[model samples]
Target: MSDEHSPLIPASYDIVWSIVTVLIIALTIVALVTLARSARRLTATQALIWTVVVLFIPFLGPAAWLTIGRGGVPVERT
Candidate 1:
């Protein structure tokens, strides 16, 4: 038998996956933090619903929150 070995997955693939995972996690965290801080923008029920969306749907959820869901008429402050 020949002494040779090869990996089914390349090292680059692992690196790419690691980067992707980190990005997704970071996106989720940022989305949640922004959601929490925007208390005036969302009511308790709305915030809860958005939290569920952001947590359950992963990439698309957070992306949607940052883009569409988070947008609205700006609240005027005294």
Candidate 2:
């Protein structure tokens, strides 16, 4: 309770940020692997390019892939 306000910095903030960063990176990697594992359908160059796109653009990357990639996947509908 001081006259001047002092911003509070939580000790665990760095840890939380580190964890979140790791998760984002892991998700990016997962997106890359998903495209990579489906290589029979996705050309090697296509998969590599998409992987770079997804990793570079953050939300835009994943969103684009989710919207476009899902549609491209072949589904057997009887």
Candidate 3:
């Protein structure tokens, strides 16, 4: 295809996508670490189930652990 007719991708857009991908990977790593720590605090069976969930379910697993599997509500801090 001629350069004029080919689809063009701006450099800035490519950089933005690269940055976003890196950020997503970093966040996933952080979530996995958090899940591991939280799992350690639970009983053996609970930890096993949570580990399975977090490892197999990707985003939803970690999110669930943070919201529903972290035991209970946090105390307010001033």
What local distance difference test score does each model get? 0.86, 0.72, 0.68
> In candidate 1, what are the lDDT values of residues 1-78, reduced to their tens digit?
974445787778889999999999999999999888786667888889889999999899999999988785255587
Query: For each predicted model, how many residue pairs clash, with residues at least 3 apart or on different chains?
Result: 0, 0, 0
Which sequence of candidate numbers ranks them by TM-score, best first? 1, 2, 3
The segments of candidate 3 whose C-alpha lies over 4 angstroms from its true place after superposition are: 1-7, 43-64, 71-78
The candidate, 2 or 3, that scores higher on lDDT is 2
lDDT by residue for model 2 (10-61), tens:
6577779888788777777777677665656777787777777898887668
Range of the 10 consecutive residues with the lowest summed lDDT in candidate 2: 2-11
**With candidate 3 superimposed using the best TM-score fit, by how many Å does residue 27's alpha carbon deviate from the native?**
0.8
Q: Candidate 1: which stretches are off by over 4 Å?
A: 1-6
The residue ranges of model 2 lying beyond 4 angstroms of the native Cα positions read: 1-8, 43-45, 75-78
> Could you say which candidate leads in lDDT?
1
TM-score (all chains, Cα) for each model: 0.81, 0.59, 0.52
Pairs in clash, predicted candidate 1: none
lDDT of 2: 0.72
Worst 10 residues of 1 by lDDT: 69-78
